[model samples]
Target: MSERITLGKTFKPHWVWAIAFGSAIGWGSFVLPVEWMDRAGPMGVIIGLWIGGLILSLVGLSTGFLVKAYPITGGAFTYAYLAFGRKHAFLCGWFLILGYAAIVALNASAFALMIKFLVPDVVKVGLLYRIAGWDVYFVEVLIASAVLVLFAWLNIRGADATAQTQFYFCVLLIAAATGVTAAMSFAPETSFGNLLPLYKPGIPSWSAIAAIVAISPWAYVGFDTVPQAAEEFNFSPAKATFLILAALVVAASHYSIMILATGLAMPWLDLVDLREIWGTGWAVQQVLGTAGLAALAIALCMGIFTGLIGFYISCSRLMFAMGRAKALPAVFCRLHGKHGTPWASIVFVCAICLLAPWFGRSVLLWIVDMSAVGISIAFIYYCAVAYRLFKWTPTQRAPAFCKETAPGKKLIALAGMLCSIGLLGLLLVPGSPAFLETPAWIALGCWVLIGLGFYLTLAREYCNTPKAEMDRLILGHAAA
Candidate 1:
């Protein structure tokens, strides 16, 4: 069988590779650790990210294995269906959609926040004040929405077109962020000694390490998103899985190095009023000063643009897959007449993005809480499935990229399970009076509880009723 399949003018490997890089190293790596580092301080942030990154490595590898086994587009939802059952699969899909949608909203909110920093004066005055809040930016929202529409069109027009865009943008973003950050760090005023024993006083306990570790995984968030492009890989899923795992390792290293360099240059102590002092423009100004600040704005604009495109693409794929499997309303699964992309799903995602403005400053916190738990649930599920597969499914002659699912497999799965569980607990801990106060964990619990309530009331038929009838009932309700 030939390895490649055409999706519009888009080539194979291109889309997969683009998403692999973009999804793994998007705004998440660039911005998340900065926020978390402020909380953990430099040393705690470093150690927590190291441990959290290791946990993500384990999950990423397991996801790669699962993708090789079944390289479908729905990611963990696909795996959850086969390993668990339809009910759990639906829950997985629901949470996955919610998680990614939260990401879109988060990015848009970040975009607006960045704009407020860049042009705070104009936004605070006269006509701008009437529409957008004082330092509340809606211009960025409009721009982000426009980008979403354009990318949606491009994605439908040709997968290749979208992939090409992703590749160039990914390279541009990585190089820009890295180059400017490095330039800023190497300035004569920057201290090499600031890297030593950087600490902040807070609730310092071994218990807090777990909390730090819980939050730490946010840096490694999108590593699993690579495997979502499993169906588009040119190589066998086996080889593709290895490449993805390697990417996670490289990405984690890149993040660690960037933070280390940045910490040395602009120690956490000096970052107390980082937001008010540096604002969203901190990263860029750290290197280029005024000239650098302009460049930083340009880079963030691009970063947000690319992030939206990738987010829409992935979420659309997910919704499309669910619809195709009759797990969601069939209309969402519809393709464009000429473009062959999931038009309905893309539109739905855009509609969802409109709600982004409501989140305001709390966007990242919400995304962290929304993503951490749902993803952890998926990770735990994958671990369980891998455990069962290792025990029940005999290993055949393996592909070179496939690791031997020996006793080590079980151990790794166990470790992943424990880590996820522990992190989930720590993340749920309420922030103390002195710390950064975010209500996302509570919000996520409320959200999940609502989902569970819906599951009990309406979705019970999905589990109890006949398959055909269940699909019909589910679709009918979703459509209604």
Candidate 2:
């Protein structure tokens, strides 16, 4: 917790944007694009994604405002502390821990699934007991473990190295995706006609779109990672909002393009019914053959790699920030001396990820899918902070902490809050299109119990500490 031990400030604007975009676009765009199309047809998916993106933009706006105001590492954790206090900050950070670390593990797990598809039974050796129907393989577990170690090492090397690497990987991932998209558009075997029935039959069109929109909380999760790195930026914090907004725009477009590419490659209706574990990959391979497969393989690897690296940067930073404030073990604040990185926090995340593949992919999917509820909770905190801090009467000037309180800012914050509530309802309310399944509910219950145990321990330890000390550690010079 020494002030001298800090994360290195080496991230540039594009590097920050890369971390946001890459983290957001990872494994899902490749594996789930066709699933999204099947649930909600091509147009339905795109429109739903944009609508989600637009709403997430409002959350991003409030998040960015606070990023500039606090200019710190913990993102929502620190934001909640500034706006509320210790209990609320811990509430925000605990859920965020599940959401962020689960994604890093998801990306690692995805690498195994990708290889299994490409090699076909080569790595499916040594069948382990099935959990939730996903056959856990010894070789697959090792593959995922290797990915976890690789990215963990990269993050331990420091933010500058990790962020720059993520930027390059982002370039490769987007280029490969665009290449396949162009190839699909011009291929003699494909046509726009295949994209008909833009909305899935059987479900009402609005319901179909709602299904996609409901998951937008998960879809656009990465853009918020930008704020976690605010303390490590070499550039002015004023640019943080635009950088996050731009990354979100690209993320939405990337998702839309992938969905379109999947539909364009084959008849959407027929392709969805085809028995394939990865419909998007299968569609691309069918249309472009080996070349498409190779390009897409590159995209998948880069996407997963970038995701692992980006989230490693964000998740570890969150722990480091929390530890610095004694919300977590103070050991998490320790950094690698030579690299000036949060090595302890990175290792903690690595340890969690290493054990994840053993649980098998199905359980991981249930856990990861339920992660949306956690992130939506974060969105509620951020916008609620914005609404409370910025909604002063027009005749009165806004507080010093609020740099920009444009007209209707209050309404925008309210809309963002309602949108977040609506998303939570979709996931938590029974019979909603995106309601949590039984397994996901069980997973969420476990996480809540675990977090409660930790929080009570921290509370007992910090109960006697003065509020001013907590403020100084969490907000630094930004403490009011």
Candidate 3:
């Protein structure tokens, strides 16, 4: 109800690219390529990513247009509210929070996993109970907990702090990637022959490529973070829209190069035989020795750190938006007096991160797989909102850059909706490459039930209030 609770304008134009690109290229960039290569090979990885990128690009286009019109903090949730209603918005925000929280947990677990590789004894310091085949250690959990608190503090300090950190990490990641690509290109040991076998043995071509496509949403998840922080961006809507597109392009290029460089550095069969899940690092060590491997580790750490920061920013803002709308408690909407950051939401995200370590590293993959489904669900809502917004009367529509691009925007919205539906089908259909396991489905169901409980209990009071009174109490604006 107060102006003080609103998010401040602090993010610059470049930070848009940094946050989105940095988030998209997180832990997955470091570890998933081997799986991608194993499924399809270097060419398959490239082609699959390009295909997935094209689909997500449509979703991105719809997101860009919607953000330009609404320019709100909630991203998909806000769009859903405008097009559908509060209930649909709540469900959309609920699933998105699950996806964002899961990602935050995944990155925290990855940081621990990476540290275990870099300094194997750190996890051995405090022997904790093992769950799902991962040996949980007190020290490993402590380190992850510490990282969560540190990132939360940085975000609580201000959006500028988060953006600055994202920018630096992204730059370092790009520089390291470029160095690796250049080094591998000229290295005597590097050979195109290593990439000779383009597909894994016994796997059908379409199935292999489809496997990569199934995971595509996880690879390009960060671009939507731009819209999550739209209110904080210090730029025109059109510039913000272009930044989203540019970030996707940059992310796609970085992923392609990284996959290619890793393949060039070593024989795929040797990489498979090494049994190193961190194949990218192993490849760097093989090609450039320990020094290069150290650099690669640092770059990878930067990637994970940026991801934690970027997703924290997104999660906190979404919670803040939900709180401001009175879908959750007002405490979540309350901003820090001096810093103007969503302190409560940051702490809430930190709490979720603290719980993740107990599940161990193996569970992190399940979390990532589950998050892919949750994210796709949110995208479906976003596409639907885009479609509805495009059809709204001039007087009902918010100011947007859609005037000249109306037809294009409509097509993108339609395609995004269809593609998102198809993705969901891929995840749910039996025997589909992307189909999630039973445990993962159960976990997702539990999360959704928890969200439903919160909505039913906390949202009722706000729903019962008069529309005018509710707007004033929640948004500090008149009802539409």
Number of the top TM-score candidate: 2
lDDT-based ranking? 2, 3, 1
**TM-score, model 2 to reference:** 0.96
The sequence of per-residue lDDT tens digits that candidate 3 reaches over residues 1-480 is 244366778888888889999888888887677867887877778878888888888888889887887677888887776666688888889889988888888787778777777787766787878788778888888888888888889889888977987999999998987887788878999998887687776778778778788888878898999889988878887776688788889888988888877888778867876778478877878889887887777778888898998999999999998888778888898889999988999999999778988888777777778888888888888888787666444455553323433655777899999998888888889999779988788888888899889998887775776666555543345534
Clashing pairs in 3: none
User: lDDT per model, in order?
Assistant: 0.60, 0.87, 0.81
Candidate 2 Cα errors over 4 Å, as ranges? 1-5, 394-406
Which parts of model 3 have CA positions greater than 4 angstroms off?
1-4, 392-405, 468-480
lDDT of 3 at 270: 74
Q: What is the model-wide C-alpha lDDT for candidate 2? A: 0.87
Count of clashing residue pairs in every prediction: 2, 0, 0
- On lDDT, the stronger of 2 and 3 is 2
Give lDDT tens digits, candidate 1, residues 377-478: 776766665554454134555333233456667567667767676666665545522222356656676668866775666554346555444333322221
Query: Which pairs of residues clash in candidate 1, taking residues 3 or more apart in a chain or in different chains?
Result: 10-160, 184-287
lDDT of each residue in 1-480, candidate 2, tens digit only: 346245667899999999999989889999887778888999999999999999999998878777776788999898887777788989999999899999999999889999999886788899988887788889999999999998898788767877888899999999999999989999999999999988998899899999999999888899999989998989899898898899899999999888878899878999988958778888888889988989998999998998888889889999999998888888899988888888999999999889899999889889877888899999999898777667446566655455454657777777888989898899988889999888998989999999988888887665546676776777775355
Report the backbone clash tally of model 3: 0
Task: Tell me the deviation in Å of residue 205 in model 3.
Answer: 1.5
